[model samples]
Target: GFGWPVIEAQASSCPVICSSNGPLPEVAGDGALMAPAEEEEELARLLIQAIHSFSTRSELIERGLANVKRFIPEKITDAYIQLYTKLGS
Candidate 1:
């Protein structure tokens, strides 16, 4: 399954720090800073960076807003429709 929290944060214009596991990378795209799920230190570093650096934060916000568009209701519906059409054929 996809990471809905990542999409929600992106839509909310909040910076994201996510673990590099499962579908998180695909879900986050270029909108988030990711660390290995077991690497607490690295995740902390990314969290600090997101909090302190204005440029990084702004970039995350910008990219997140763009990345979130991929999951819009219309797009998801269209994708499902396409899949079902292909299956039906």
Candidate 2:
């Protein structure tokens, strides 16, 4: 399941780092730094990279803010309405 933490971080303008498994990648989109769930070393490298690179952090923050807009109330409701309409047809 997609969790609120990612959304919260994005909306708060914090750069996110999440595992590449499950719905995390979908929720994070291109707004996060992702490594395979079991790849601790890779995750560490990504964390270090993110810490060292101001531009990377800035880009992630911008993209995360944009990605979170997809979850706004109106959009979620509209998406559900669309799906229901499609299913009923």
Candidate 3:
């Protein structure tokens, strides 16, 4: 699934701490910190970690900005165009 919040957070330069459920871990990748989906305590811990770790927050913002580039509208369109071109060949 396309996780819009992840992208939005990344694009907005916010630190993202997400659950390691579904495509969140895959999509957020290294750009965001994670907690196990079923563990409420783990989620709280990660949130607390993010709040206290200035370097971690900065790292997330940096990586997230880079990750969001792949989802830029023009970039996605380019990928489709490239795929169609390859198929045409």
Among the numbered candidates, top TM-score falls to 2
Clashing pairs in 2: none
TM match of model 3 to true structure:
0.90
Q: What TM-score number comes out for model 1?
A: 0.92
User: What is the lDDT, from 0 to 100, of the residue 4 in candidate 1?
Assistant: 94
lDDT value, candidate 1, whole model: 0.96
Model 3 bad stretches (over 4 Å): none
Instruction: Score every model by TM-score.
Output: 0.92, 0.94, 0.90
What is the full ranking by TM-score, best candidate first? 2, 1, 3
Query: How close is each model in CA RMSD to the real structure?
Result: 1.2, 0.9, 1.2
Given candidate 1, what's the lDDT at residue 65?
100
Could you give candidate 3's per-residue lDDT for residues 1-89 as a string of tens digits?
77889989999999999988888887787899887888999989989988999998999999999999888899999999999999999
Best by lDDT: 1
lDDT per residue for candidate 2 within 1-89, as digits (tens), equals: 66789999999999998899888998998999999989999999989888999999999999999999999999999999999999999
**Global lDDT of each candidate:** 0.96, 0.93, 0.90
